[model samples]
Target chain A: MSAFKEFSKGIYAENPVFKQALGLCPTLAVSNSVENGLGMGLAATFVLVCSNVIISLIRKSVPPKIRIPIYIVVIATFVTMIDLSMAGFFPALHKSLGIFVPLIVVNCIILGRAEAYAGKNNAGLSFLDGLGMGIGFTLALMLLGVIRELLGNGSLFGLPMLGAHFEPVLIMILPPGAFLTIGFVLGFFNWLENRRQNN
Target chain B: MKDILKLSSILMLITTIAATALAAVYSVTKPRIELKKQEALNAAKSVALPGADLNAIYDVKGNDKVLYYSGYMDTTKSNLVGYAFLTSGRGYSSDIESIVGVDSTGNIIGIQVLSQTETPGLGTRIEEIRYGESLTWVQKQFIGKSAKNLAVDKDGGEIQSITGATISSRAVTNSIVAGYEDLLKQLKETN
Candidate 1:
């Protein structure tokens, strides 16, 4: 029945990257750069919102037996659109995101939302749910990107922030760095969530 | 029985419609995708080896552990600039690929990373920063250095290894050494 709270839950309670852990592949891959993470997050948001709204409108007609395959077909269609548009315009981000763009078809966040919320909720709520989750996903990705870029490259968005005194941690830019940073951030988020619950 | 048959037919109809729509989208985007790939290749070549006036390029087959690209450069003024070689060597986490511009006398002119999948902070020094905060080291080490002493100074060579990424540093040096030798051999037999 509530609207604003539905949106807010996505940021903290149901954070796709850290809490729900949906779409882990791109969250890990594109988090290498703030630009990459932000780009991927926005593109994913487009797909999630569009698919959720449409699915919610047609939920009753889509028979339960064939709903899973139908949801995939819908998601894959939107992903292909993002792929073509990115390749045409933003070739650099397209290259960075690479195969992960197409792989969005299988991202649990979109499919899970479609099956759960979109299938039951009204179209308005479904749209809000998608938007909220998307912004949450984007925020988490940017947070990771900023940390990784600052520590690894000793820069934020390719501009030197710390100057000569900073010793860039070599491992922060590697694959291991992604894992370690995400793990630490996840732990921190969990700690914050627990503390919030206690309060 | 008639009702069940009608329901099955309806399912088939939905599947067909969805398939048709998906196929239409693919057909529309396929050519654009191909053109984008070609443009990206040209851009990468231009940045890696400046002003090559690149002709056709090829990925050399059956080589040992290196991704190689050797191609001819067609000059504008009725002259040739010899072959350009893009070869790979070992780096911190993966093999480092370098694009080399060479003249007829086998002297190295300029080199840059065509692409690298190295460790972000540590091994990325191969693209070492020359002046600014850019990755300048990797490209600069090739300056004035010959294919003769491509190995790092530790291995009785001239080039210095990156401070923390010695293995990655040496990996790149070894790749360059071997890559030059291989490319040189190819250039000689063909020319």
Candidate 2:
């Protein structure tokens, strides 16, 4: 594949969240507000790109049977760095994100990409792949966050856009709200794909 | 045998690198993290007891998990505004922890849910207040109410429970009341 294609594929054609449906736990848990969505997305993105490059650079030396453990160790280090740094620099956001930060180690997106793409590709190509996948994941979370925040809290990015009279749909910000929003958004994407194929 | 040895060595090398990197990052960020934690406690103190001297806050050494901090007017510590303490108890999904501010008259000045693992929507509404927009937080129900009156309306008290989060609401009210009682006992002992 061309260099640009490698970077762009994860954005839409092979998007991790909407298209592939990978890493939904963190996506749904943190997408209730724009701030949380962006925080998680960027954090995951950092982990993804760094792990991809490191795994790719060392893939040749790593034996096939033990690759998974090596990949995990690398991904976990980056996740810890993000977790500790966020607590120090962005304490409030770090507190809100809570367990999800450490949980990033288990997020399938990071491990899956390291196994499938970075394990075989060159270091540069793998880095691009990671960037594409990370941005794609961030954008998807932001979209879900916008919808839920506006409906659930009558606000966008913590700003109360709706007047005082506006009563929010409480369910939209709850756990059930996470499932409902993702389901509808996924359905919309599927419908769009179907329409394009018909033409 | 040769392949096994190579595999083990490579894995060991990777693990070593990962550990070193983590240690480096942790050392750099440890002081900052501690500072942030102290700042959070300080910020919560200010919010719960506005205008109280940050320097005059002192730990009263509770017997249990409850944390009590006495805020004084000056260095002499003769005048006391009230007490701010942290209370944690079982809620619907997880432990509900709150920092409550009680005035000298035993009225709740303010209550801030410090940390909670309650369900995201219903039970988690305890910490859902807007700062300047409108104070609709579920915890605000306790503000200005006397410690004696800190029960859900269903129990014939002044506090209004969240519609679907009666358990979570009661958890908070009961904890605050417990903290208030403890505060009174400690204050009496000290004075």
Candidate 3:
């Protein structure tokens, strides 16, 4: 695949959240607000890109039998780094993101990318793949956040958008709301892909 | 046997590197993280006891794992203004931790949720700040209520539960009541 194709595929064609359905846990958990979505997205992206590059660099030396543990250690290091730095620098964001930050260590996208693409690809290509995938994940979370925050809170990014008269759906920001939103979004994307294929 | 040693060696090397990197990162961030936590506690203290002397606040460790802070009006520490303490209760998902301040009379001065992992949008609304308000609506509701009588309206108390978050609301209220009683008992024993 071309370099651009590798970088761009994660945004739409092979989105980690909407398209491929990887890392749905964090996506659904933090998509309650745009700020959270954005924070989580960027945090995950950093871990993904860094881990990808390092994993690709070490892939040749890694014994296949031990690669999974190596990958986990690498991923976990990045997660803890981000977690501590966030706690130090962005205390409010850290408090809000809470357990989800550490949970990113288990997020399938980072490991999946490291194992599948980065393991086989060059470091440079792996970096692009990680960036693309990270951006795709970020965008997907933001879309969910926008929808949920707007309908659920009658606000966008905590700013009142729908005014006082607008009663929020209430369910849109809850767990059920997350499932409902993701289902519709997944359906919509699938519909779009099907239409494109038909045409 | 040779391949096993090689694989084990590689795995060990990777983990050692990972551990070193994490240690470095932790060392760099530890002080800053502590500073942030201290700052948050300080902020919560001031908010919980509006106008209480930040410097004069001191902690009294009770026998039963209860620690409460006494806040005074000045550094001279002559005039006691209020008491602040950390309290927590089981919420829908996680423990709802809060710092509550009460005057010498046991009426709540103010409260600040130190941390909570409750359900977002519904239960987490406990931290939501309405327009043009500094204190969250939930925090404001606790002001001036007698800690002895603290309970959600669901349980026939005066405090109103956050809409759709009765559990979280009840958690905060019950925790405050329990903590306050503990504080009074501790204070009596110490005096």
Candidate 4:
């Protein structure tokens, strides 16, 4: 694939959340607010890009049999760095993100990219893949967040948008709301794809 | 056997590098993290005991489970604002942590739910304030009420549990009551 395509694939064709369905845990959990989704997206992206570059660099020496563990350790280290730095500098955001921040260590997206793409690709391509995937993931989460927040809280990013008269759909902010919103979004995307093919 | 040796050695090297990186990051971030935590706690204290003299605040040895801090208005100690303590209890899911402030008379000045993993929209309502002329705030319910008065209304106490979060509400109330009793015992001993 061309360099631009390598970087752009994750934005649509190989989208992490929507197309690949990776990292749904953080995608759903943190998508309650735009700020939260953005934070998680950027954090995951940082971990993804760093781990990808490192994993690609060392892939030549790493025996395939032990590659998984090494990738995990590398990904975990970056996750801890992000977690600690977030706690230190962005205490409030860190507190709000809570366990999800640390939980990123187990997010399959980072490790999946490391194993599937970075292990075989060159460093530059691996880096682009991570950047694209991370941005796609962040955008997906933000979309979910915007919809849920607007309907559930009648606000966007905690700012009142719908005004006082608008009674928020209380369910939209709850767990079930996440499932409902994601289900409809996936369905809409599928329908659009099908229509395009039919045309 | 030769291949296994190579694999194990490579893995070890990777692990060592990761460990070193993490240790370095921890060293750089540790002090800053501690400072942030202290700042957050200080902010929570001021909110829980608004107007309490931050300079006069002192720590008291409590059962190791909970740390206690008391703040006074003046050096003479005539105006004792309240005692602030950290308390946690098993809620519907995760442990609900709260900072509770109580005056010398054992009346709660205020309580703030510092952190919780309760179910959103339901159990999370413990942190919500209902809108109306009467003004019903869940955590604020305990404010000005004594430990003896701290039970769910369903249990014949003043507190009205959140409709779908009775367990969480009860957990917070019980934790506060327990902390209050402990504080009272300590105050008596000090006196």
Candidate 5:
């Protein structure tokens, strides 16, 4: 596949959350609200983009024996930058994101892109791949957030669309709800892809 | 020999860089974090006491420390109203932070939860309209009553616990009770 095709495919055709099932920690954790999911998704994107560029630049020097460690350090450093910016500028968002921000260093999407694409591709290609992948991840998270907030909260972003007495589904906002919703969404996407192939 | 030296030097450089970066980030963000926390405390206090003028506020112990915001009535001028205290306890899932208002008479006027991460639709009822906003059912149990009554009604106290959220109800009550007992004793000596 062309570099652009590989990158854009992640957007929805092979979304990390709904399709490939990658980078799930923040996907499930911060997705309680669109605001939180979007925040975390962007942070992950920045780290993914920076890590991809640096990894591609230094791919030759990364001894195969220590390549994993090198990629980790690059990703970790960028994650720290996002963490610091959030803490300094958006304290509330920082508090909500909390430990998940630091945990981005190990997100498979970042490491997977670095090791697979960045290791083999030119700097330009790796950057595009990362950007595309990040956008895909972010869009998935926003979708999850919208559905969860609307169902559980009886509103969107704390705004009530339903009447005051509209009792929200208590189960929709709980931990089990996250697992169930994501599972059903994944299955539906797979069914759609399968039907298209059969045709 | 040269290879070993190069590897060691690179590793050392990475460690130093990482430590310096983390330290710098902490230094810049620490103040903003603290200020945001203080602003939250002020907001909580204003909600607890609608008309009183706040004097000062600060934290004690740890992240779990009790936050105290003292204020004086505009009319009495010198009379000290009870201190609005932030307290918490280890609930079944997450720690609960609540602000309990105490009048000078050692009576609890009201209480409100600042923030929490408990089970949504379940323990989150602490912030629900009936329990948090209307506060008539839950918050009323604390009003006019002293710390002595801070227990589940099943435990032979006046507090009416939520049907399904008993643990969370008990968690807030116990924290308020313990905090009041300790603060009341300290206030006795000062008076």
Candidate 6:
């Protein structure tokens, strides 16, 4: 596969949230606002790319029996680093994200990428893969965020867009809204994929 | 047996490296993080007791822990404005923590939710500021409310609970009330 193919696949065909269904916890929890969704996406992407590169570099030396533990340690170190830096630098975003920042350590997307792609591919390819996946994840969250924030709050990125007359759909920003939005988006994507395959 | 030792040793080495890296990051970020936390607390205090001198505020310790803060109108520390305290209560999901300021008469002056892990949309609306408003609706409701009238409307009190978030609203109200009562008892004992 070309370098571009390796990177582009994660954005559409194998999106972590929509297609693979990985890391939905943060996706659902923080996708209510564009700012939060973007922050979470970038934070997770940083961890994912960093961990993927390190994991790829160390893959040759890692014994299969102990690779999982090693991968977790690497992934955890990056997660904690991001968590602390975010708390120190962006306290407001840190407060908004709350526990989800630390919970990124448990996000299966990073681990899955480490185990499946990084462990097999070279560091260069792994970097591209991680970047693609992170962007894909970030985009998915932002899409959901845009939908939720617009409908639920009648605003986009904290700015009022729909005006006073638009009665905000109360459920769109709630927990059920996360599920409903993701369900429809997932269905739409699946339909798109089926059409592409049929053609 | 040899393979087990090798695997364990490798895992141990990886963890050690990870720990060391984390320690370095923690040290670098610790001061800034502490500063940010202090800054947040100071900001919340100012909001809770508007015009209270941040520098002049002093902690009232009980059981070797800070129970509340006594804010003064100025750095002279002569004129007492009110008391600001941190309190938390179990909400629908996580603890809803807030800083509440009450005047000398024990009527709340202002309040700010310091931290909460409530549901994102419904429960989290406790911090929501409606269009064109500065203070959140929940914070605005608490101003001038005394401990006696702190209960949410659902509980037959003056405070109106956020729609679809009665549990979280009640949690903040109840916790503030409890903390306020505790502060009064402590102040009386000290006097």
C-alpha TM-scores of all predictions? 0.79, 0.91, 0.94, 0.89, 0.84, 0.92
Candidate 4 lDDT score at position A115: 83
In the range B1-191, model 6's lDDT, one tens digit per residue, is 99999889888888989999999999999999999898988888888888788887888887898878899988888899998888899999888889998998988888998888676657877988877788796668888778655788988888889888899999998998899988888888766
DockQ, candidate no. 2? 0.59
Candidate 6 positional error at A39, Å: 1.9
Worst 10 residues of 4 chain B by lDDT: B130-139
Candidate 4 lDDT, tens digit per residue, A1-199? 5999999999889888888788989888888777788899999999999999999998898888888888888988899999989988998678778889988888988888998999999999999999999999989999999998788777676666877688768788778899999999999888988999999
Worst 10 residues of 6 chain A by lDDT: A155-164
lDDT of 3 at A79: 96
Task: Kindly give the stretch of ten consecutive residues in candidate 3 chain B with the minimal lDDT sum.
Answer: B58-67
On residues B136-171, what C-alpha lDDT tens digit does candidate 5 reach at each position?
444666767776556888777767786666888788
Higher-scoring candidate on DockQ, 2 or 3: 3
lDDT, residue A173, model 5: 69
lDDT of all predictions, in order shown?
Answer: 0.75, 0.86, 0.90, 0.83, 0.76, 0.90
Q: Chain B alone, model 4: TM-score?
A: 0.87
Candidates 2 and 5 compared by lDDT, better number: 2
A1-199: candidate 6 lDDT, tens digit per residue? 6999999999988999999999999999999989899999999999999999999999999998888888889999999999999989998889889889999999999999999999999999999999999999999999999999999988888888888798878899878999999999999999999999999
- Per-candidate interface DockQ score: 0.30, 0.59, 0.70, 0.52, 0.37, 0.62
Q: If both were scored by lDDT, which would come out higher, candidate 2 or candidate 3?
A: 3
* Candidate 3 CA-lDDT value: 0.90
Off-target runs (Cα >4 Å) in candidate 1 are A1-5, A197-199, B1-32, B43-77, B89-97, B128-135, B164-171
Candidate 3 is scored at a TM of 0.94
lDDT for model 1: 0.75
lDDT tens string, model 3, B1-191? 99888888888887898889889999999999999899999999998888888888887775756478889999899999899989899999889999999999998998999989787767887888866677785677888888998778999998879889999999988999999998888789878
Q: Pick the candidate with the highest DockQ.
A: 3
Candidate 5: where is the Cα deviation over 4 Å? A1-7, B1-4, B56-69, B74-77, B128-148, B151-164
